[model samples]
Target: MHKLNGSFSTGYALLTGLMLIALAPASSAQESKEPDIVPAGETKTPKTRVLELGAKLLQSNSPLKRFDIYLVGFHPMKDSPEDQMEAHHYCHQVNEDFAQCALFDGNTADANLNGIEYIISEKLFASLPEEEKKYWHPHNGEILSGQLIAPGIPNMAEKSLMKGKMNSYGKTWHVWDTGHEGKLGTTLPLGEPMLGWSFSRDGEAIPGLVEKRDKKLKIDTSEVRKQREDLKQYAKPQSGVDDLKGKFSRPTRDIPGVIDQGNARSLPHTTE
Candidate 1:
């Protein structure tokens, strides 16, 4: 078990410096796939822009500065499995075992802030009450299947980060239904907040959901999955992996190393 120690901290500092330099230009590889959604609201005037610049220069944004890690993944509404959207997460690693993220519809400057997610280590998750477990979704499926990725980071750094997050769980809530993948969403945040869940099995995500994301982001999820094959050994059966089972119409295949808690039958042969 690798602890988040001095070496990791040094690496992260270096990585942050690299990212800052690399992203100095407008055309950054780390930029989100899509542009800002919906042509709603009036354009900003010179006065407004001046005021925003002043705030940026003078405001104490210490909390915002902590959000250095950028991750991208898809989340489906727990109640409505088909209601899925790509989530861009700007996260702060509060500690070795916990992280909090601000979820957005896109990664652009104009992206909509739609949700929030709290991540916890497996150890922390184990301490959670059994009845409360359903609120958290396992991360092994997302990590091993390569559905979740930290964009712009080196492979080694990303893998190290993902390895630390193995067996973790995240509780997410989407408060706004911003438009996604050409679908127009509510002009404003409407209705109650929706709980978000992970895609445990292959094909659970709606057709074209991952495809469109991969195409736009220039990522090959298959290759990323292959690269992460070694991380499977760290995975364990997690609660909520089967919560959405049989919900999708598509034929689903079991992702190796990702099984629901207590469902021995669903465990991959390799794992056993």
Candidate 2:
């Protein structure tokens, strides 16, 4: 009787072990198959497609007509009326034309049509004919593009003596200091670089330039509030991913995937 009991116990244990093994792979597979914008720890094609499409749109060949532009919560356009005015004043001081854009919410006053939440910049802004200029708010980059932080040029000394070199554009240009700017964003209107003005993450300055600025000298007022009573809300973090998914009509991924990889999956992150 003792021998029989031992055999039965061993048999039962073996059967249970086999059952777990049989089910393990399917469970793991299900978890892996959960909706992902990009494959876990892998590159996502949708991300690349969005970037490529954006580039194509920027190029003369894209068929995009009247894309609805949007701004984020903390940038110049997102500030209160007073802060918005300040940003405008500052942009004008530097000769930039950045403006505040917003949606057609019922609250938009006839006078406040200038404050729409989307800004049209680059060739898109310039593409409008002269008559359209009245309809299109002036983009500030034209005024802000040449702001300087350098000592006056020997032959030409003026307030525009940017001691640094132009690095990138964010509706405004970013000039990297020869290395003495304190508290980044000290000099000009480059609040955040939205458009790729050709500088690279590798710090390669265009193709022929090889000078390093001491520090970022521009005081990019991308998110400064001009008023005290205004509140701002950023579009959900997954907004970009959703936009891409919608554009392609592909399956959408969770917000975590979008945040973990900004357009690029497998980006190395720093921990504090």
Candidate 3:
């Protein structure tokens, strides 16, 4: 685990203070109705404190920032409905259209790594072939339903930020299943990667878990739902990677724990 040196830095403390303010209820009624505004309460856990400090430090130096999103309707095997898992994502956005996220077993930061998700713009997604598209998922349900959220930003700013992400696609694979066992095992589980999907309909997410998340975060997802009504038309259908009707295997060329050399070639080369 990563540790912070000394006490929490002044910059982190200040950013946390601002986040608290930004998450509070406004004094005026007009301000309350603004989509960009939401409320937050005090921090509770050591892990959260660490994450806050880390997020502050990262945002100070780079364009990276974090958002928490909940996802369900997952199955490790194609035919097994009993193999579902619930996951929470801590996403660090690298830019407007690209983000790499770490997935956790639950809402808390201490939860073990369930998997990772890479999100990219529709343009990048369109560049992929039809077979490759099956491994990806759409963001419409996660966004319009208010399941995907940036916690600290004011509603308007978050709304504006999400506007760019509204049409984006995500490629995710689950490596851990906390539900089957009480805790994560010592080693990486050996199996084909499980493709993840978002809740496609009302009440698809576990109601109890959703309530717990809203209560813990002190933000009403229903309000977020209302605010994003206009963006619903932009929502992508449950096709391509979103289709879960058939038995799908992991891409033959996509190996776990190995970076794709072909894809890496597109990255900018740097020499010392």
Q: What ranking of all candidate models by TM-score puts the best one first?
A: 1, 3, 2
What lDDT tens digits, residue by residue, belong to model 3 across residues 1-272?
11112121232334345556765542221111111111234546999889989987886743334443323223232234224444555666555457777776554424566688898876677788988877776665666777676564556655655565655678877765445322233334457667766443444443354555566556787898788787654443334322432233322221111222234455565442
lDDT of each: 0.81, 0.23, 0.52
For candidate 3, the TM-score is: 0.56
Best by TM-score: 1
TM-score preference between candidates 1 and 2, better one: 1
Report the candidate with higher lDDT, 1 versus 3.
Answer: 1
Between candidates 1 and 3, the TM-score winner: 1
lDDT per residue (tens digit) for residues 1-272 in model 1: 32332322444565666555565431354645654466468888999999999999999999999998888999988998888899999999887678899998888777888999999877889999989988998888899999998876666667777777788899999988886445678868889999999999999888888888888777789999999998877677788999999998879999997978879555445523
- Show model 2 residue runs off by greater than 4 Å: 1-115, 141-272
lDDT for residue 62 in candidate 3, whole number 0-100: 39
Candidate 3 regions exceeding 4 Å error are 1-86, 106-109, 180-191, 236-272
What RMSD does each model have against the real structure? 3.7, 29.1, 14.8
lDDT (tens digit, per residue) of candidate 2 on 56-151: 888774222322111211111211111111111111111122232232111212111122232333334446565643332221221122211111
Give each model a TM-score.
0.87, 0.16, 0.56
